[model samples]
Target: MVPNVRSSLPVTGTKPRTSWPRKALLILGFLFALAAIALVAMAVSQNKPLPKNIKYGIVLDAGSSHTNLYVYEWPAEKENDTGVVHQVEVCKVEGLGISGYSQDTEKAGLSLQHCMKRAQEVVPEQQHRETPVYLGATAGMRLLSLQNRSMADRVLSAVEKTLRSSPFNFQGARVISGQEEGAYGWITINYLLGNFKQAFSAFYFVMNFLNLTTEKSPVPLDKATSAVESFCSRPWHEVKAEFPKIKEKYLSEYCFSGTYILSLLENGYGFTMEKWQNIQFLGKIGSSDAGWTLGYMLNLTNMIPAEKPPTRPLSHASYVGLMVFCSLVLVAVLLLSWLTFHKPKCLQKGLI
Candidate 1:
């Protein structure tokens, strides 16, 4: 006899099964509760302070005792155990500033070029070469006679020849003021301490002009980017006019974030919340801190910043236009010089 078969089926026309939807709702509720708890934990953990990227490398022939080159970088993952944020040391340059030099590097370009070649060898990343490199002389440069420190051509020429055309890809160096220096110092402290999220949170949500409730932030930022965008539009001074209570602390946050974004745009490097998904308050380009220092010196001490004027700036965008115009001008000048030196025959030769 064949094995008997058994089947159990619902009664005809009975109500259809409906347990799947109920189970899904239950799981979702549980997940929502877990997420809420996690958010609270994250907020509370942020209270404790942390550290900063002390990424120093040599910029000049910095002698051992006085050669203290301060390096800053976004901590690397391998350095996490040490609580470091900087992974790469992007830039370094010799001398404090251009105003400290006197030589025209046109004839001596080779020697300057050799020094830069050695410097660039340390870190060969193409991107690092373009990071904003800056220089600012100390009291030493100030002591030089006007003739001794005439750096307009020497500095510019040296950069072009020595550092392989701005080895750190600096648009230019600017002398900043004391206020700026203080601002950077404040940022450096906070960055080292990891006090940004809370500091920012308090400023945007808790301490608005109206003192809005905690249920929502006072500012209309749905996310960090939007908040930053609003801040960028107004000068930090203007923003501080509204809040006299925590003016110093708030101003520090404003400057750090503002300078980072400005550096990102100016250097063709984009900084984003995405880059900062797991990180906090630091940047890739060198000299925000240095800029902060120069800023303080200039703003507070009432000093002047100097520069090397561009020897040849191609106004047109395309290389073809630049080459054609520059070449024609050079040839004409050479011909004129020859004619000036040797009259009739030289003039005829130039015309040909």
Candidate 2:
């Protein structure tokens, strides 16, 4: 009678025990959630894009008129890619071109000190040893070699000595061929204009010879002839007044330069009037001068690869996202399986 009364009365002192399976399910869910969180953290940390590793290069364009020091830089990862390399700085060496220092061969090297120092300042001190510095003498040095091979050698030696003394890795100092100059100029213009990867037609004419007097007149290409003729006919005082900022020496050569360029384009290169319209009189393309310097550096450094680099089918983010999605689906499947296998006995009995 006492036991029957106790069974009928409410259990006051004791609480119902939690099922082991239910506790296990809760712990598994917490663990799976923590695992998912960890997977997400790992994906984010491991797949993030790395910082850019920039590489520097130096090229000295020792032209007939003047010497130009060009500092170029590109990402180390994209060295083989096109349109990535660009000019960062251009320092003009004062006085004259290296060939002009033939009288005092030692001064040819000394003249480069200012620009080389500027390059040192532009590039990091640490990179100096790794940065390759190249000096390519163009028409001036070529002419010097033709006139006097021994003098050209001495001039080159002097400049080489100076470059070797610097912190940079001196590649070489020598006179490049006209064929090389023309080819490199073409490469520079097209490269800077992004023409390598697309369909385009263009021509680049270097007016290096225009500083001297030319017997040929401007060819009739569009308004080029008229413009040059009109400018040349103007009074010297008027010309000076119009271009006050231009140095007298350079201003005086404009007429000759215009005429020589037109003649070269039409006669030397054999371009018709129609083709002349397509010619791009570009001094620069996006801060980079349209010249042989960049092309020269690119060739020596092997920055431009002949073949395209391999690429991944999926982007980094897409790959990571897909992994996370698959992980979540797996977690959901496991949760459903646990629920199906560990259903309450009452519910299972009701189904039966």
Candidate 3:
């Protein structure tokens, strides 16, 4: 009875030792998870969309007195949206309006070459072919069309030819009606003032009276009228001496223009004496002129959408982040399951 030794002795409690292969597998899995997390972070940081792309457009406002080229720009992604398009540059063509070249219709087109070149310089070279260039002749061309329809057509054709030759996508040149001009002018002013997005029901009127009479007179109607008359009564030389900076041509017409504007507002538009205070004579709303050119472009390009576009709940970044988190959780669950189900046989036996 060797010290009454038991045939089967209870094994002492000992810690389970993991095999090198299992340890390596666990370390490799951890490293792989870290690499995956780093890869996701890199993708999120580096693979975002590029900077906002700018789109360009050109509008030629061929008024009764002169022609002006306006270069406009907006974000490319928001094409059919409002309050995005804005004027960048405005180049006035030297000499008279396109309609003035009725005698030598070919000169009408040539007159626009300078402004066209300016537009080319203003807009990026890559966007030339796609950039739409429009020519809108106002009262002058309308008057020309009334006086001589054939001549107006020829004048328009000449300008069209010139525009077509340019790198931009030339839209047709046409003489716009007074009503159309007024409506577009209204749109332009309101658009620049951001009235469309506001909660208001007030009506706005735009009078494309005369560009020469844009000088804002900060006085009552009667006083303004008397002042204009007094200014007109003075001798041309004396007036020129008093205001040397004023162009003689424009200076001479101030009285007539001032009177004409007053009459037009009071009689033509039917505004009362009290309502006169509401009249706002603005050459520009912001950087862009308060005129029909911007409205014309907006209509042609359908930049102002009829209805708001539908939107998703989550932002792009948020959606991506959510997806990456879900992917990581799934990978972790799979790795844990694999480690549990594919444990070494020795380790399983030791546990038992």
Top candidate (lDDT): 2
Question: What does the lDDT read for residue 104 in candidate 3?
Answer: 98
TM-score of each: 0.27, 0.67, 0.69
Candidate achieving the largest TM-score: 3
lDDT of 1 at 226: 49
Tens-digit lDDT string for candidate 1 (1-352): 6554444544566565568546655555565555455444544444334433222122331111111223233222223233233323323333333332434435333333444454456544554653334433332333333345455435444544544464465333323333443464454445444564321111222222222223222222234444455665777677778667653643556645544543553354443434433322332124333223322222221221122222222233443454455456555545554444456974467545
Model 1, runs deviating above 4 Å: 1-100, 103-130, 137-161, 164-168, 196-352
Local distance difference test, per candidate?
Answer: 0.38, 0.75, 0.74
* 1-352 per-residue lDDT for model 3 (tens digits): 4664554777686866658657767776676676577657656665666555677789999977689999998766564454368899999999888888999999999999998999988998988998888899987899899999999999999999999999998877888887888777777777888786421111121122222224364335665566556766878789789879655765676667667766776898786777666555666676888778888876765643233444454577976787687577657756765766687787689769
Report model 2's TM-score to 2 decimal places.
Answer: 0.67
Q: What lDDT score goes with residue 335 in model 3?
A: 72
User: Relative to the unseen true structure, what is the C-alpha lDDT of residue 160 in candidate 2, on a scale of 0 to 100?
Assistant: 97
To one decimal, what is the Cα RMSD in angstroms of model 1 from the true structure? 35.8
Candidate numbers sorted by TM-score from highest down: 3, 2, 1
Please identify which of the two predictions, 1 or 2, would achieve the higher lDDT against the true structure. Answer: 2
| Off by more than 4 A, model 3 | 1-30, 33-50, 77-83, 196-218, 236-252, 266-274, 303-352
